[model samples]
Target: MTQEILRAEGLRKSFPGVQALDGVDLTLRPGEVHVLLGENGAGKSTLIKMLSGAHHPDEGRVLLDGQPVDIRDARTAQRLGIATIYQEFNLVPQLTVAENLALGRPPRRFGFVDTRAMRRQAAELLARVGVDVDPATPIAGLGIARMQMVEIAKALALNARILIMDEPTAVLTTGEVDRLFAIVRQLRDAGVAVVFITHHLEEIAEIGDRVTVLRDGRSVAEVAADTPQNELIRLMVGRPIDQQFPRRPAEVGEALLTVRGLSRRGAFDDVSFEVRAGEVVGVAGLVGAGRTEVARAVFGADRYDSGQVSVRGETLARADVHAAMRAGLGLVPEDRKGQGLVLGDDVAANLGLVTLRRATRAGFVDLRAQRRAAAKVAEQLAIRMTGLDQEVRTLSGGNQQKVVIGKWLVAEAGVLILDEPTRGIDVGAKVEIYQLINALTDSGRAVLMISSDLPEILGMSDRILVMARGRLVGELPAAQATQDAVMELAVTDVEASRVQ
Candidate 1:
């Protein structure tokens, strides 16, 4: 019989406003890859945080190799061989890769730190992840994908026996994801139990050996990875999600947005497209394909060398975010915490961000007006919290995303640009978002959606545009678009396509 490496029983946690987890239980065996699944408000993160010692459970017990242990803090958990890689990276940008890897336990000799020894250790860890990088390089100079690799190395260096990864592939390309899977397999072969948490269903089948479904802070079911896909999805969603994406009838109206000869130096170039009112135009491509960059340029977040963005035939100025807003455009960025929300604020406060002026009276803040407006959308989105005053940081990943989308919903713009809007969200939340998108178009608003998930793009888009490197390569009608076609365009090899 395989030995159980880690176990949590009757886990319970609560805050002033919400009971994040309630009587959750999980168990893992050595050399096994266990997947955790739930919808946005299902309490997956809260449970992981408790298991990793980021938060103490109000009630429950944790067992490591049949021994009960008291883990009050992250350091204690690390000492007990549990390493957690959160979705939001915790690396210091100013530090060198080697120094960051050996921050807490650097080798010391003769009252001096051993720099050569640190580099050797960092390099070996990087090699394990199939990443080749100079240990002397500063982390800030590295891209998001490379930084993720460094995080994996740091986790391994700690001799972690039970590793927890949250949304590990949210920022990786296909090739990088494959490389990561190989390392995960190696770890499992060496008897390291892994608790994998992801929004991608395909990954559960690809890397997971067993699956545990969580619903409203409880373990609903546990099964082998080979369990039928529809059955597993039903367990997590609490309903038969026969299809991940549901198509809506499209009525492409008058062109609401037109981008002509859009070019930005070293980012995107000569991109042109038209989005009609009551239509969704999907931008599909692999990572670094300039999909998000295009949305940024259109929304005036980045400067463009040459291009004309028009709403209802009126030209928009470059690098003018305020002007873009005035021209009836709203952008839901990919990086929610970094660019989407004020993490330290409450849900009502974040919801009032876009239209704060409207909620004020004669330069005096109107508390009632802000609450009334925020409460309406909060209810519409079904955001679960004690009240609107609850901190956004305490909410689940899906709830955080809802707040981000709620801001735009209240904006009521003529044009909406969403970048990876459904990423890291659970199946039920994704379905809600899809319905919301349909409502947006039904109300005569145009949507420019940038997503890496092919099913989302093909099912929701009235038309699709694919980009590779920095150039737009192909456009397909939603009826004709398929997973294979989008992949072809995203990974196409054209020498001139790479961005500088």
Candidate 2:
């Protein structure tokens, strides 16, 4: 029997109105990939935070190699060979790769920083992860996949015996994910214990060795990595979900959003599309294919080189977000935490964001009316929050997303652009979001959905627009669309050349 590397027993954590984690247990063995499976708010975050020293467990103990240890802070965790790579990269964007790798504790010789030694160490670390990025390049210059590699390299810098990766493949392309998995396998072979957390069930069978399912802050079951997807979904959500993407697309109506010659010089070009009322127009593409850029431009978040976005026959002014918002366009961005909601504010404030100015009465905003409006939207979306006064930051990712969508509803937006609507949400929350999409479309609203999730695109979209190298390559109706068809159109010429 293999000895355990790390263990958590009866771990519990709490916040103001929510019991973040009730009692959770996890075990990691050397040279094994231990997967943590859970919904967005199912105590996964709290558990990881406790392990990584970001939070203290209110009850229970963490054991490392048969000895209980108190992980006081991040430094202590690192010292104990525990490295956590969160979904958001922690690298300093302004610094070079080598500088970021040696950020806090650069090599010092006679009290002077040793730049040469730092770069050499960084190169070794990068090579260990099979990443070939130059040490001289700034962190900001690297793409997401490259940055992820750099993060892994940074983790390896600690000579990590236990690696905790949170949604590592969430933003990665297929090829990049393969590369990452290869590195993970190498690490596992080298006798490192890995804790892999992801919302994508498909990856579990491929990458994991053992699984611990967390539901409502409790560790319900520890099963094999090869567990069926439906069973895993059932365990995580504590219910059998009949449909993953329950999209009941409404009857098609007149065009509400029309984009003509939408082009941004380097991001995207020659993009033209229309999202009609009561339909979902899914934009499918690989990373850096410029789908998000086009969405941002359409919402007036960014300026396009030469193009016009029209809402109901009226052309919106260039680079004017207010005009776009007033013209009935609401954009639910991919980075919901950064762009979709103001995290520090309460639920009512975030829900009233789109209608703040309109909800004012004689130089005073209607706080009472705003709360009422937020309460109604929250109830409509079934947002599980204590009250409207609760901070948006404390709510789960799914509830936060509903608040983002609810604000637009409060504003009465006719066209809602959802970018990766169910990105980090669980199966149950995803179904809820899909039903909301149906309701929105049934009420004669237009939805322009952009997603990297191929199955989601196929299942929920009425029409799919495939983008490659910043251009619209092909379009497929739901009747003719499959993952293969979508990929065939979305694959870049570089992939074709490589395949040949």
Candidate 3:
């Protein structure tokens, strides 16, 4: 057997009110992809952070090559041939892609930055990742999917012996994910030990060599990569999810949000759709399919040319977010942290964000009512947090997502536009979000959900709208919307006269 590259023994970590990791043990071997599997709040993040030197464990130790080592910081870990790609990006948006790629260790020529060499090196990295981005483009200019690829490339620059990737495929398209998997396989063949973490269980069998399941801050089991997904789900979530989607079809009602001739030039073109009350209208598409653009146009987050957005028979002004909100339209954006909630504030404040305007009288906000409403919503969502005053930035990914949805719920939105609502969320939290969707539709509200997860689109959506190349190619009812059908439409050209 190959010798172990890294080992963790009885790792324990705690916060003010949370024991993040408790007696978690793990072993990694050279040239192996070790999947750190868990549901949200299952201590997976904490364990990885400890190994990456982002957080020090309260108890237990890490061994590298059978020698006890203190991973004091990220830099120390990197120097010791360990690298990590976190869920949250560690990139500078203002910098060019080439500059970001060569951030810390730029090649110098006689005390000057080697600009040409940097671009050349950046091109090679981008090619390795199968991304065709110009090295000169600013990080801010690229979409979230491209940004994620850049993160992977940046980590690859380290050429570390041990790599830790967290939710690396969350933002990628199906083709991009395949390319990433290929790169990972290459790295594994090159004798690099990879620690992979993802909420998507299918990826475990595809890319992982071994699996470590964490549940409630403890490592519950170590199993083979080819273990049945049902068993893996049971191990991580502690129960079988008989119904992954659990979408209860609601009676279709009148249209709540309508978009006609929505065009955003290069981003999206002539997109039109309507989400009706008491229905979950799912927008399914590949990456860059313009689903998000169309949703944003309807929500007035982005201006649309030659389009009309109407809510409850009232035509909304173009590029007016406040107008959309006043029309009872609430949008859960794709980049939740960047657009949804205020990270620096407390839970109560974030939950009250959408309603603060109405709650204010004579320039004085009603703090009492806000707190009461936040408390109710928090409890309703089962958001795990110590208190309402706790910073939203500190909560787990799943809890933070609930806060975003709670903000809209507190506003009593008649129509909710959810963009990738369960992007990085685990199976349990995903079901919770789906349950919330059912609750919304059951209460005579409308939901326009945009997602890349085809299974989710097929399972939850009452009616599916497929987009490709910035156009709505086809629509399917719940009974007829299979994954194959959606993909067929998703890959269809906009100019096609009829569905293939």
Candidate 4:
């Protein structure tokens, strides 16, 4: 039997107005991958922070090998063989891989840094994690997958016995995810306890050994990794989710948004499609397949080298974002935090952003009008928050996404463009977003969506458009679109070229 290396008993934490974690207990055994599953505000982050010494539990005893220890700080946690790799990497982008590996503790000889020894050690660590990049390469130049491998290497460098990974595969491609799983398995075989946190339910079966579900600041269920996905979802949300996608049937109307021969040199080429009113058209593709580029071009976020974009039979001027907005087009961007919301601003302010022109009067802002508009949108989206004055950055991932969508709703956009609308949100929140999409389409609004999750594209789209390399390769009705067919069109040059 494997030894239990770390244990938490009755962990409790509280914030200003939230009980972040309440009586949450967890046990980690060496040579096992224990998955921590939860929704956006389910106390997962709070528990992880306590374990990693970022926060102190209000009431709990943490045992390391049967001995109680107080992890006072991050350095103390490191010394106790506990390392955490957060979703947002901590590495300095300006530094080289080797430099980042030896960030705090570089090799020293006679009070001087031993650069050669540091590089050699960094290379060895990278090799252990199966990362095949030069140690001298800058971190900014590497993709998300390679950077994740480097993070693992850094943890190994610290001799971490318990590794905590928070949403490690959130930004990785399918192939990259496979490689990461291989490395994780290798670490497990080598007797390292891995605590993996993710919103993607499918990953539990793929890489987890044991699973723990947290909901509303409490640990609700603990089971083996082989537990059915439906049971896990029930445990996480406290009820069975009948439908993952709440798609509704809508009559397709005349084309509200149309693209013809849209070309962005080196990004996408001759992408032609139409999103009719009262329908959701999903663009499916692999990473770097120009799905986002196509969406950006049509929305006027990015300038296209050539092609025409028309809204309701009227041609739009190229590279004009204001024109697109005036024509009743709205975009819920992919990077929601960075591009969608003003993090420092309050919920009311963010919701009133796109509709500021309408809310303003006599060259002065009308706070009362803005508040009313924001309240209406919040009620429509069912956004849970302390109040409209609460900072958007303080809200959960799902709530932040709602704010992004609510901005467009307040703007009264006729055609909406959603890029990875539910990318980092939880399953429960995803269902809510899908229901919102249904409501939007039912109101005779058009939607053009770009998504990498095959299940999402299959479930929500009225018609699926497949993109490969830099072009629109194939189109299929949602009823006839299977995962296999989408994959074939997304990756195979022969089939894609023939269809194009």
Model 1 lDDT on a 0 to 1 scale:
0.87
Q: Estimate the TM-score of every prediction.
A: 0.94, 0.95, 0.98, 0.91
| Predicted structure with the largest lDDT when compared to the true one | 3
| Candidate 2, 56-132: lDDT as tens digits | 99999999999999999999999999999987688998999999999888999999999999999999999877778
Candidate 1 per-residue lDDT, tens place, 1-500, comes to 79798889999988776677889989999998999988877888888888788899999999999999888989999989899988888799999999989988998879799999889989998988888789999999776678888898888888889999888887777778999999899999999999998888888889999998988878888999878778877898778975678757557789888999999888888999999999999999887788888899999999999989998999999989888888889999988888999999999999888888666788888878778878999999888777888999878777888899888777768899999988788877888888888888988889999987787889899899999878889999987888988898888775654553
Listed per candidate, the RMSD to the true structure in angstroms reads 2.4, 2.5, 1.5, 2.9
Per-residue lDDT of candidate 4, residues 1-500 (tens digit) = 76789999999998877788999999999999999998988988889888899999999989999899998889989999999997657899899999999999999999999989989999999988777889899999775557877887888787789999998877666776787789889889999999999888899998999999999999998999989999999999989999998899688899999899999788888889899999999998887788877888888888999989999999999999889998999999887886899999999999999988866789999989889989999999999888999899878888999999999999999999999898778899999999999999999999998887788899999999999988888999998999999988888584445677
- Flag the better candidate by lDDT, 1 or 2: 2
Q: How would you order the candidates by lDDT, starting with the best?
A: 3, 2, 4, 1
lDDT of 4 at 398: 89
Give the distance in Å from residue 205's predicted Cα in candidate 4 to where it truly belongs: 2.1
Off by over 4 Å in 3: 495-500
lDDT values of the candidates? 0.87, 0.90, 0.93, 0.89
TM-score-wise, the better of 2 and 4 is 2
Q: What is the lDDT of residue 99 in candidate 2?
A: 95
Error of 1 at 394 (Å): 1.5
TM-score of 4: 0.91
* TM-score of candidate 2 to 2 decimals: 0.95
